[model samples]
Target: MTDRHELILTCPKGLEGLLLEEARQLGLEDAREQTAAIRGFGALEVAYRLCLWSRLANRVLLVISRFPTTTAETLYEGVRSVDWAEHLEPGGSLAVEFSGRGSGIDNTHFGALKVKDGIVDRLRTASGERPTVDKLNPDLRVHLRLDKGEAVLSLDLSGHSLHQRGYRLQQGAAPLKENLAAAVLIRAGWPRIAAEGGALTDPMCGVGTFLIEGAMIAADIAPNLKRERWGFSAWLGHVPALWHRLHDEAEARAAAGLARPPLWIRGYEADPRLIQPGRNNIERAGLGSWIRIYQGDVATFEPRPDQNQKGLVICNPPYGERLGDEASLLYLYQNLGERLRQACLGWEAGIFTAAPDLGKRMGIRSHKQYAFWNGALPCKLLLIKVELDQFVTDNRTAPPQPNAAPAPVEVARLSEGGQMFANRLQKNLRLLGKWARREGIECYRLYDADMPEYAVAVDLYRDWVHVQEYAPPRSIDPDKAQARLLDALAAIPQALGVPRKKVVVKRRERQSGTRQYERQAAQGQFLEVIEGGVKLLVNLTDYLDTGLFLDHRPLRLRIQREAAGKRFLNLFCYTATATVHAAKGGARSTTSVDLSRTYLDWARRNLSLNGFSDRQRLEQADVMEWLAADRGEYDLIFIDPPTFSNSKRMEGVFDVQRDHAALLDLAMARLAAGGTLYFSNNFRKFELDLSIAERYAVEEISAATLDEDFRRNPKIHRAWRLQAR
Candidate 1:
């Protein structure tokens, strides 16, 4: 019944040491590795040549019986002593599949219904007809396993999972399976860069699993050579002249690896709906003239290829498993490490991630990494070689040198409390950089904790420099408040001329519930600042508040000078930057509200970046159930909220000094008569519930909404207004 069988194989769990070195280079015998299989023995034509050449396998099996069960009646007496009328017939159909649990044969669907009732009671006691169970095309699939308590069973010879090689029938929202993209192109060596003729790419390619697994490892094709149907195609120990001599030697080594000369494989894909389904999965893996698929965009991924070729730039990117998707997948892995250091410089990248801290912000470095897993997540890959000394120029994004001057304040390498925090950050950058370039303000708040032993606040945004700190005070000394926060993050990129990766830092503490709207770094690095003249969208390294609020710039320039055709309303609209300054002061309709679907998707990308998303709106509920189911009124309201929130998407526990009188009586019942409202919060022991100044006339505009960069923290927030009288 065998010519030396045993096998096993499996895979995808960090590719069991690259599927035990490609099953001992296909001959298999005594192979080894285990967790995520490999085991091995051979013949039966090396498990039909690892089910037609294993590209990091996923099921090959074969074994047929191993026994020693501990329950389900000794696993139905080891599947009725494995005969099953010589591999399934008596009206053939079969399926099984069982996998691990414990000796008690813990449920894998009742250990696949007791091994399909011991292979239909041993083929209905000598062929009285019984088979029938085909869990989708199964003239006998079988498997079993059990482990530790031992059982094994086997047989599913390469069926539904040879990573399906059925040319991804349209994929994308996280795909990568084709044998984990052929074990990330055989650990990014891409078969010695396609045997030295070198040329591959990917640049975030999605439906093109690493350009059809690097064009079937550069043409030596046969990753399940157009897989038709297997799991031992209709068992009975299938042989058909030894599988037509290994399927006609893998279709003549895939037609002499596609008649040689084509290898410059490409891919691109910024989802123009995954570029015609990745060129229809490279024209169904006949590799449409050696991989191509375009629709570009990793910040202009350019790989014209054939200029003395340099191959291998692979990708997998988007490791952002939800939660604000790493703030734009940290600039899509820094625009794929700046298109591999400006267009594949000495090419050889790889990447593949599950957030190895967003692939170390892809400033590029990985001189080899590996790991792998993808199915139960795990991941990694990395590799890199696009050298310029592995490029990490403080996580890239450099470019600005026109007049190039500001790198001076190395204040003789600080440490006298970092030269008094670099002379109070060069005296608040020469007095808030001349009142933020004479009020054109590109985002301000220069220094806030002003020297309370570098408590920190910093701010800037334009030339980026966020900072924050202020956590200390547990009677200080946690290694002296982490050496005064490493002397104010080494004097904030040299007193702010910037570039310590344009400084970002965090800490601030004392937050609760919606913990200052969570995510402190997925790096989706937003930027674009401006202010009273509209532009907003700040991210500053994914949240702790950067979606603009430089002390609400004089109350969003007094809601863009009393929003013109007034209808505004903003309420806790954290990223609505005062509803884009009340829709750039025109506001005939705005809305905003927010229970934080990550700040209402950063207030719908700051109202679709300024064109004010056609009359704005946003509303991700619970701003007190959308202002008591808003009866639609608003003539400019603002609100702010959050001196404490409970945000399990709310329904209890908001305490801006105990729900500032039912949140200013639900914004004065959506105020329409004499409209007005405003009412801010930042707590600082808030109070204003003076029956809202006797049913609304109030005023205190918190010292005229303190601006010039938060006039020395005027409690940082507190406004008023009201009206409806």
Candidate 2:
């Protein structure tokens, strides 16, 4: 009985509860989510069983102990205090991985080494032998997480991140973790869909994580069975019978299941960049002959013609964050909408996006929507009824009048979005009024250059060019949105004195190459800095978002002044405008986070012209992970995460409108004592959930963050300033 040990498992965020339920269904007691990981005290059998059976885990880390440690020295002491002699061999090779530091520690390597030395020292002291550190193939793995001054250390029972799932032999540029993909499918209700042998497809499948997970679910294949070995296998005095019973049962279940040809599942992606990897991923899943993947644009993608079992189409499309060029992206979106209505009949469509406005383009009355993280970008996976025309016409009419004061619309509220949209809108409006100053223009740039929203504006002298953008609006219909933008732009020609012939309204599209963005953007060239001495607009609104955000103007000024000598950290910083403002204000240094390489270049230009280009630092990362990893202090920190975003390729979804408090708290944590955290969200009716500001001195600085151009619409920015006292 002494052999029975306690172990904790962790699933990715949001799947903890489900993983716990799964464990419960298996009759495993004390199995539940603990923090981002899961916890369960069971015999070594449960630990081994979970490794083979879990479908939604990043990895299975056995908890050696969970303790509170504040500093580097404390972490070492705590680690040394653990009974390392109980597990690691004196002469064994082991490794330690440190994650979730979040502006707490400066160097992760130092922190990881400290914990490692502590473990080895403990072993050396007792056993007269020490284990060599092997980061890749360690005999024993240790995990150290220092999040917000607290540390949770666990033994890495699953050598690789559990998401490895033993599938996906090849790596794509941004492949979705298999475990995350499974969670997405499950969250989207895949079991219900899979039970019917309903086919499932991922149009943007980079490496077939979703498709494989879906297939595994269909075949009853345990996601972990493919892993030839697990950490517990090497445990001393391991019970072979119990482990064998679980492994054999799982294997038998997978083998005995009928894998109706993979024709029921498919994946398609336009960029052939993922084709080779997709093939490898399918092969790795042992489903090369079972699943099909095609290299093509989603617009032209047709559902499997042979199989009559219409299935669900789940996809994670490109968003403005990483794939800029909004107007052009509209075409892809409009076409996808067309495809959703046309090709996916009788089949349900699951569209995951951080951009709610983009979701509207699909033109379907969604059956369900799931909130998740696509890295730091807040996103939603909308499960829309495929029979849209019928569903919309028969079920949900055009609400009598499109813009009629949104009467008593009862959204079967998911406890997530948090606030009443109308109430939040009312508050944001009152707060942002003092900041919206009208620069003479034909149209007010609603989202152009605002946080989360990346639409831009161009100027021709007094008159300005306005481009309309909907930042993944969930409530608005895309076709209606398109009409609204057209109307807004139509008035621009009359308002700006530029004839419709010269107006040149270009709906932003993805820039195919650096040459295209620069070349196309240069076409309608002219210059002006009309209002507030705002300069530099080459022909106003051409290819992408104009030049600047009229809303964040006030906030930029704040940065310009307060930045004089403080280090600046810009999370989700695009175009480097804020950094320029900070550098111009005499900031010591600026670090900007953005995934797009194009915008980084543009930011470099904006800063270079202002003589602060040399001070800018750029990091291409999924903001959530990056911010979690960043321990560097900044005097001024600016984060404007998108309304709804998910880089399914990155294993998380982000929804600013829903995840604001958490995002703000994390960003604020990075702020130095007495430093300023300037956070903004363009979620129209954003309400800062003050409850989360408990850790810091929080204040609503909406008026201060608002810019001159956004004076007309007071709800453009939900801005705040938080300070760590």
Candidate 3:
């Protein structure tokens, strides 16, 4: 009856996939992910339900006009062309919001003013009366965006950023935005994980973001149920009847999906800085009974595996970018890897860190690495693929699907290059470890010679020996490998000469690479922030990702120290660890978004096995579409897109290496200005499109976002801090 209404739910760039999935979950089946927004046809009720439930969006923009216009005069004509009476009451107060990039009228404010002028002039000319302009609060809000010389006029359906989610009373530094947090969980693979008996865990759980998000995902709870109003509700076309129906259906679905197992989402952090905030946020999200929070250390973090399968080990460790010393972070990572390997045997583990060195410490090859923007800092999500006996793989060679954030890490081993160097390095590594062991030094070699290209990396912990990173010749080359192994066995006593029984050698193979952060960095030109919550050493270099992805790092830090009353999204997320960091920060719910199924599997292991959030989860799909169809807004969002990718499903042959302009434009469109978009890109040539919509300001924060090891390629990722104006 009411011309099938169309609305747009804009989300951070690269989060479209999770957003689309959110829409589908909320019964918005027809929902679809766009380049930077989600489009759907629904009644006002559907809009309201979306405002109340979506876990991965920044704002819901209701398109009022889609027209081709090249000049300000053309903009006026178009605005006048629309039936102003249908939206604004004759004398009703109205406000204008504008966004544009590479358009004839680049000034967002000027464009908004022009649109406002058009609406008032038309109303006055027609009825001898016009609506008054109200900047702060208005009965009607008109939103306009100029893109590539084109304009899309829309109504601000959700006046405030959906990230406000009507919760979050208390917060700490750089708390995760609700939508971003939810996106993170989705990227980590939440829906499927919560559907199964798997568990979710956030080791550095801060304010309870990951915890609440986990509960919501497990219970299928709408992320925005507590919100009271949406911009669309105040519009003249607001339909109470349809809105009520959508609300009713959403409620029914939520009620029906309320029960799930190992849904025991928990946030654990020793820092007192996050406890109160975490508690407050949990209550704000109305997840008191379902999720739990604790104050403790990750070192002592020992969680029991579920009877069915081991839980996921999700964590956002300190990259030392905003915290500690980067030169030695490898040692901290070494400890983290050792603990996971020794204590978490049956489970898989997933970690989210801007610093790849920290992930390497976990001693597992990453199967998936996503590029995400934590504000404007280009970063990666390294999904450590842990092999476990439980769980079977799903889907293979599927049709083209969706979009989301940026992530580029090693996808497969580079078998062609550096073979000779690898062999030499491997031989040297084994010899060193064996010499150390035999010499009886109270040390443990963490890596050894196994694969040929990796070239032998070893760690010496307190009492154990781990060896990996060595390249073996091949199946036909067992002799060389065996000779190296035996030589090293003899060398252990030669290096330190303890005893064969005291030495433990582990072989590791290099996997595919989506990114390579092997450059050397400069000295203390960067700052490193390490709270015990982050669990990392102070020195180290040559990490895959920087320590902090300005976009999501704050959320992870907040989870380690603050996530109080919000949901979190980690779009194009690699591991749910950042969500775990949010959980530690006290978030109520978390959704991890990503396209790699292998990473999702690791996400479950990281969460459940490590005793993080058991409810919040992993989602595998293209992030672009996910953001496009999502119905909810989050308090926090972690936007990280990849540098370059070509999959059968997602369109626009993406290459952060090239399309960063459109990429950032899409992400900012969905960000809650007062909210954040920690935009990050590793394209050494990465530069902010200062010309893009001026609605938000970009702050070059590469220095603050960098860790010591990544200094070699200071340009590896350039981070920008963004806030809606």
Please provide TM-scores, in order, for all candidate models, with all chains considered together: 0.37, 0.54, 0.53
Q: Which stretches of candidate 1 lie over 4 Å from their true place?
A: 1-50, 54-84, 88-122, 126-156, 164-175, 178-196, 199-309, 322-433, 436-543, 546-644, 647-703, 709-717, 720-725
Q: How many Å off is the CA of 380 in candidate 1? A: 21
Ranking by TM-score: 2, 3, 1
Off by over 4 Å in 2: 1-4, 66-83, 98-114, 125-128, 144-153, 171-173, 237-241, 258-263, 304-308, 321-324, 388-725
Sort all candidates by lDDT, best to worst.
1, 2, 3
- Model 1 residue 545 CA deviation (Å) reads 3.0
Residue range 564-670, candidate 2, lDDT tens digits:
88999988776666777777788899999986675676676666665565768988777887878888877789887666665443556777767777777778777
lDDT winner among the candidates? 1
Cand. 3 Cα-lDDT: 0.59
**Candidate 2: minimum summed lDDT over ten consecutive residues — where?**
410-419
lDDT of 3 by residue, 1-725 (tens): 26555778888777787788777665564788788688887755556667777777777776777888877888889888998888877878888988875446767778888888899887784547778988777888788877777788888877778777666777655556767666766667665677775667776777766677777778767776656666766688887787777677767766776643336566677688889888888887767766677777765666554445556666666544421132234444544554555456655555666665345434456778776666655556665545542212221221111122223211111122323433443454455546544543322233333344334444443322333334464654665444444334333322332322333333333423343222234332222223324332211232333333323343345445545666667776765557667776777777888777645654655565445655486777777666666665565676666666665556656666466666555555555435566666655565566565475666766677543223333554566666666
Clashing residue pairs found in predicted model 1: 327-524, 415-418
| lDDT at position 66, candidate 1 | 88
All models, RMSD in angstroms = 20.4, 19.2, 25.4
Task: lDDT for model 2, please.
Answer: 0.65
The Cα local distance difference test for each model comes to 0.77, 0.65, 0.59
**At residue 325, what lDDT does model 3 achieve?**
38
Q: What is the lDDT of residue 42 in candidate 1?
A: 81
